[model samples]
Target chain A: MTPYDYRDLDPLIHSRIRLSILAILTSVEDAEFTYLRDQIKTTDGNLGAHLRKLEEAGYVRVSKSFVGRRPVTRYRTTEMGRGAFRDYVGRLEWILHSRPMDADQREAG
Target chain B: MSEANARQQAGDDLAVIRRLMEDARETVSNNGWHLVLWGSVLAVAEVFDYWAESGTLPVSPRVVWSTALGLGWGISIPLRRWSRKHAAVDSLANRILAAIWIGCGLGLMLLGFCGARTGTLPGPVTPGVMAIVIGTAFFASSSLCDRALFRMLAISWWALGSTMLIWPHPANNLVMSAGMVLFMAGPGFLLTRRAGKPARMELVA
Candidate 1:
């Protein structure tokens, strides 16, 4: 397969946990940190680190607030994040459908 | 990875994404108690009003309606608070559903109490308008959550409301009451039964 076929696949969203986070956020307006933690089935530290990475990349926006005495943190996908996810999925679909015959033909030549 | 393995991995990733999205959407549609509570309250009030108007009950219609509204609000507020506090996920769909129902309730209240007292809206037409408002809410909810049952409920409410509007009669109270039972309470009960308990998750330490 040519490098062009899969080159556009987003490296940041290709991981399982980050991909799952984006998928969940895409389905809802926002989600609590604990909800993401439970859904991803990952350790708090692991989820936090990945979230920080996504936040730094401007893919996720975080909001912190107090519910009574407890502090609550919520996350939402940024517009860029949504766009990236859509593009990532699109690339995956294209790669899955495209055959590697061009590379084979080049080898035969 | 081999081409076949890459394809299989891509397919698996898509499947996981689909499952998570479905799970998130499902959370917004699990609220059933709100419907059952309001339906029961309204049904009881309608029946009591019917009996009183027919001279079978000794209570005043005003007293019955007042108590019914009072009880419905009294329970609904706390229940809403509790649910909000306990919810694991709060989606836009949930917020939209709440807004729709709350708006419908307030609109009905203003029409029923203020409109009736001001001699603008006749008492006989109040129920029909209320049903139409409720049906509109059900329709919004059906569209939001993609529930066919809610669509059916919307149609049922519209049909009942139209009947009451077209044919003004004392027995319309009974018909409205039955609509509450069949469309509102029955669906609420079914939703409650169909709602699955939240799956227990094993957290990583």
Candidate 2:
């Protein structure tokens, strides 16, 4: 068996969509709203809802505007979010490692 | 029952799922400089073009350009908000960018306001001092962030301020252009490229 810390283990981070969101945020300095939407394949409301969750947690920040009459949006991760994610990944790896065989396994027929 | 319970209770598979999600998320995120860069480039170009075509001197030019930047800032907020739903704004990096966008937008607004009034703002010193002040603000803010790409952008602002204050180029916009190109766009383009390379790698791998 393995021991792990799950205090801030936001189940929000576990969702396939949100997890992907966090993952993408970790790689670059910042990203755009449209860029994230196209890659994740979720509807406008769906992605927005998840992002709002992240924002509430102080995991991400949002910025918006326009260029030549066209609108623009950008996103970036917070230091807290970054640190939390790294730790989450670390805990996940630790959790997945197989433990020593149980006594019953030694006697399997 | 003992062995089965032990294995099932561990729920190790959940961990695997999380890791996979992280990998997949990063593997997919990015829109490159296509949207924001093009917008910024066009906006800046428009301001430069107005200067070139009209040669209207102080009043109209600053008013027009500043108004334009103000509009740009207002527009960027919604654009950014909309993109979040699409997939681009779903990540951590992009979230931090929110503050940057706000800062830049506000800075542009301030610059625009100042520029609009600078003609009456008394001597060229006001404009120069304003440039230095705004430039210093951007430089300092960028410095506080740890990201290399951000630092590059800070240098660009610093260059613009220094050039205006010390070198005082009346005839050459090239110096400013070079500042954006070398410090802002150059590094931004490179970083965008750097970020995308990995997303493409899985396909090759």
Candidate 3:
């Protein structure tokens, strides 16, 4: 109903791709770069960019290792990211449920 | 934004989270090769031990078990390395599952070899102790993965172990062998079958 009510929603996690990435990471302990790309149905470059944004925000942690000769990258959500996601979801729920009350108040006023 | 648009966006976001979480759980739970391999090996070893105990086989029980356990470890170590190298994802559930089973294996080795040789654990009651340890592992695994099948197996192992401990008869060897085949190998085969079906369908597609 007002900008103040939506202030708690994280802009970084508001985008569809970033939201999807967080959702996937929250579900599993860790996931490989290729796994996330395939699940999100995005190109490597696009996925990598979103991942980097989240990494810079300290919302995700990446680990690099070698499986024989080939290098592998894995990602997981950090504690801060988990907390932010929870707050975002809680705020979203509040917004969804409080809209009717706000509408009723506006009509009365 | 309009109320209708905001509501739609919220619904879509929640749906995406729900669907992806379910998919991740399904993918992580599909692994069953280690269970199948270990179950088959243990089942065969228990059966051979039963035969030797019954005088149906002339070989010593000690020799049969040692060779069987040795062979199991020899194969399992390499197999685990290969699986870890090839795994597409490393989940917390998988790690906990591996740790539970690895700890179970070490407990069995200590009870079977060290405890027995040192006379700290009597030879006759060793199987019962091992069974209890296996049951505990299965219980832990069931709790971790939320699988009813593992809980049932845990109960079965506990019952078998209790029965052997109470009776303490020579014929319990045959009973233990039967328990291994029915409980361990049977579930292993079922898990392997379920895990393989998706791969086969993918190949066909």
Cα-based TM-score, every candidate: 0.77, 0.46, 0.77
Candidate-wise lDDT, in order: 0.82, 0.53, 0.76
Docking class of 2: incorrect
lDDT of 3 by residue, B1-205 (tens): 7667676767766777677666665555544677777777887887787788788999987898889888888988898788767666667887788889899998898788888678887756777777888899989988666478889999999999998888777666667767777777778777767643322111000
Native-referenced Cα lDDT, model 1: 0.82
DockQ score for model 1, please?
0.36
lDDT of 1 by residue, A1-109 (tens): 4423344468898788898899889989888998888877888899999899899999999998888898999999999999999988776775566667844665477
Please give, for residues B15-69, the per-residue lDDT of candidate 1 as tens digits: 7878888878877776788889999999999999889878899988778888999
Better of 1 and 3 by DockQ: 1
lDDT of 2 at A102: 25
lDDT of 2 at A66: 67
Worst 10 residues of 2 chain B by lDDT: B196-205
lDDT for each residue of candidate 2 in A17-99, tens digit (9 for 90 to 100)? 67666776776556777656665666778888889998899998888866458677777789988887777666555444534
Q: TM-score per model for chain B alone? A: 0.87, 0.55, 0.83
Model 3 preserves the real interface contacts to a fraction of 0.40
Q: What is the overall TM-score of model 3 with all chains considered together? A: 0.77
